[model samples]
Target: MIDLLAPELKIVFCGTAKGTISARTGSFYANPSNRFYRTLHETGLTPERIDPAEFRRLLDYGIGLTDLNQVESGMDRVLNEKHFDLQGFREKMLHFRPRLIAFTSLTAARIFFADRTIRCGLQDRAIGDIPVVALPSTSGANAHWTRDRDHWYQLRALICRAENPSWGEEQKATE
Candidate 1:
């Protein structure tokens, strides 16, 4: 799968692998039940709701998209360890150096970190100098496991701070 990436992106969302629907459509998070695009707009990550087919347009908003298992398209359970290309993922992040690498699901974050105990939020870890964040799975199947979208909001706020250092003060003044 071709990655939607560019240098100096604010966030690069990394998922475990594309689903069958996404692979077929040649788009990231093409599954309608997946709330990937909706969440972006809802969390104020993007100015408007973007269609999955137009995913490449996300670069305009300083967002990029990629998956761990590029050669396979399926859920985490259906995929094997060898399918995940951690080295390739590292190379991309090192080369492009996005400000943040946010995993679309906790499962993806755990796999990349090689630590099963990792939780959902901005972690104390780094993929080199870049920070890593974990968000809830927007998959319809995992709907029961999600508590709320606060983690995503926190991520967007962090990105906002990076974009505008005085964002917090501006927000306080507005309130």
Candidate 2:
């Protein structure tokens, strides 16, 4: 139930709720099958792989984590509307004001977006001044749909573009 947040972060990864394994292990994205941590490294968002148990160390990498449904732990289908606190999520986003709020799953982003018209990459709208993005879930259960890591790379590209547009351009040239 603890939110790993701070001020002036480059990105904050938000999910619908903790999965059974994550809750039991007291670690965000603790399930070995979950690709969250691996994606972070693969996307160049982190210099090295990070253990779920050491999630707090993400702050050092300018990243944070949270959930839309803080009161429950399961897949989105099993969750009820009452479990989600969109207002609290808004408050948190406003308070922390991270450059980006990257929802770890499309389901979580839909609730925040208040509509089903969501995409798997950077959103057209921003939550206040902070940009929003809906990412494919890293959950193994959703692997059928979340298998593409291109979306993850797109996110990193966005961050890179924001931090240094020329840097992103150069990286793209090499690709």
Candidate 3:
């Protein structure tokens, strides 16, 4: 699948690799059970729930998408170290410079971090100055983690704050 990337995007979502459905459909997150587009809409990132085939439209909402293992297409269990391209991902981040990078699964983040123990929010380490985060996989196979939407909400809040300095001030005042 083609990467939907551009310069100065607010956030870029990175996944482990394309699943069979996504690759077959030539779209990002094409599996009907994937929650990626739905969660984006729920968190106010997108005005509407977008279909996976319309993945390019994400750039209009200041979001981009990519995969760590661009050459492979399958579940994580079937993938190995050779399938991933850490240097390529790093170079892409440095070049495009999205404000934040969100790994769509812990497995993807772990692979990127060189098997280091990492968490589900923003990390201390960054690709140059761009912040990095790990979100629960939106894949149906990973429903246990996907059910928690807090991290996704926090990401929206962070993006809002970054774009507008006074964001959430009214909510705080009312509270």
Candidate 4:
């Protein structure tokens, strides 16, 4: 699948690989049960819930999408390690220079970090000064992990703060 990326995006969500439905439809998070779009809306990252079919519209909202294993299309267990080009992904991040890079699933983050202990949240490590975050998978296939909105909300706040340094302060004042 073609990566939906551009320079200076607010954030880029990277997945391990395309799920069967996503690959078949040529859209990111194409599976009906996937919460990716809904979470973006609920976290106030987008004005409304975006349809999976119109995934490219994410660019308008300052969001980009990519996959670690671009050559494969399946679940994490089925993806081949050789197809995961971490260096290429890093190079892309260097070129695009998004404010944040969020791995859509902890598995994807683990693959990128090569550290299975990496948690699902902000990491101490970064790629060329760009912050990295790991979010719980929105895939229906991730039955082992419970779905959580807190991380997604945190990501939104981070994006707001990145865009405007006083955004978090203003929010706190309002509260």
The per-model lDDT (C-alpha) reads: 0.89, 0.86, 0.87, 0.90
Clashes of each: 0, 0, 0, 0
lDDT of 4 by residue, 49-159 (tens): 999999999999999999999998988898899999999999999999999999999999999999999887888998988889999898876674454647877997777
Give the per-residue lDDT digits (tens) of candidate 3, residues 101-140.
Answer: 9999888999999856887887878888777888888888
Could you give the candidate ranking by TM-score, starting with the highest? 4, 1, 3, 2
List pairs with backbone clashes in candidate 3: none
Ranking by lDDT: 4, 1, 3, 2
Candidate 1 TM-score over all chains jointly: 0.90
The residue-by-residue lDDT of candidate 2 on 1-175, one tens digit each, is 6999998788899999999888899999998988888989988999999999999999999999999988899778888989799999999999988878899888899988888988788888988867788888888888655455578888776776556647756887999
Best by lDDT: 4
Candidate 4, after superposition: displacement of residue 121 in Å? 0.9
Q: lDDT score, residue 18, model 3?
A: 95
Where is model 2 more than 4 Å wrong at Cα?
145-147, 163-175
What is the C-alpha lDDT profile of model 1 across 69-126, one tens digit per residue? 9898988899998989999999999999888899999899999989999888888988
Model 3 ranges off by over 4 Å? 161-175
